[model samples]
Target: MHTDLWNTCLHLYARPGVERACLNLQSQGLDVCLLLCAAWLEQRGVRCDDARLKQLSDCAEPWQREVVQPLRHLRTQWREASAHDEALGALRGQIKALELEAERTVLRRLESLTQSWPSDQSQGDCDWLQRMASLAGQPDCGALQTLRAAINRA
Candidate 1:
């Protein structure tokens, strides 16, 4: 199982449809870091327990909410203006870098939090998806299923 959370995320996200699925879920208020962690845990065969899920969520939520999301918002909102304004474009680039750093930090924290978890027998992909969905406040959706499938393929 891949223990490097950031690298694992990059690899998984490079797969077809995975990025779209993640962005869709994120737009719906799902924490992408949490989703990625859930996928990694599932890949590792770690049993998806409530306490573990809560721990991971607690670790990532604050950083994602405070740091990552704001940078993402700024960069995304500036996309059109940035194309026309050099200064705004440069600022957007910085924000994008910061957003990436914030995500990396969160992924690193997640990796540390889960590193000690011993791999167990396969508890199935649906198990982690259900737990993630519960935490994300997302009802069953095609994107969620796609994410689960993409993660396993990763």
Candidate 2:
């Protein structure tokens, strides 16, 4: 599942424009979080859908409600609005706002989930070092060595 999520994140982050890449990553990451949450709810014999989304986010303030519930609505508008339409400007603004909020909410959900079962993360510090080490011919061994020293101290 983590590998699948990493791949999805990578693909989304590798898109053309910076704004588009950020938005895509935000959307894809939120989708993964939503799937995970829905799975957890389903296993407990709970039905998860738009109704559940509203109920879960009901106590949230107006901005939060706008972020969680109107995402689909904004996406639909963004997709349907013609490129030549002047109304596209407003839709784009709303989409960007919702994207930012969704990213924040998904990050919070990920933090909570990680706190709950952090041991389930099988990846280790070495994985990061190995990936970084493979990136260049003359890598910054100093940084890597410092990291290793810190780990040893821990």
Lowest lDDT block of 10, candidate 2: 117-126
Expressed as tens digits, the lDDT of each residue in 54-106 for candidate 1 is: 89889998898888988898899999999999999999999999998899999
> What are the runs in model 1 whose C-alpha is more than 4 Å off?
122-126
Write the residue-wise lDDT of candidate 2 on 1-154 in tens digits: 1223233333333433423423343343223233323323322333333444543333233434456547756666677564667688677777777765675565455434333332323323223322323322333444334433332332
Best by TM-score: 1
TM, every model: 0.91, 0.35
Query: Whole-model lDDT for model 2 versus the true structure?
Result: 0.41
Tell me the number of clashing residue pairs for each predicted model.
0, 0
Displacement of residue 27 (Cα, Å) in model 2 is: 12
Cα lDDT, model 2, residue 86: 67
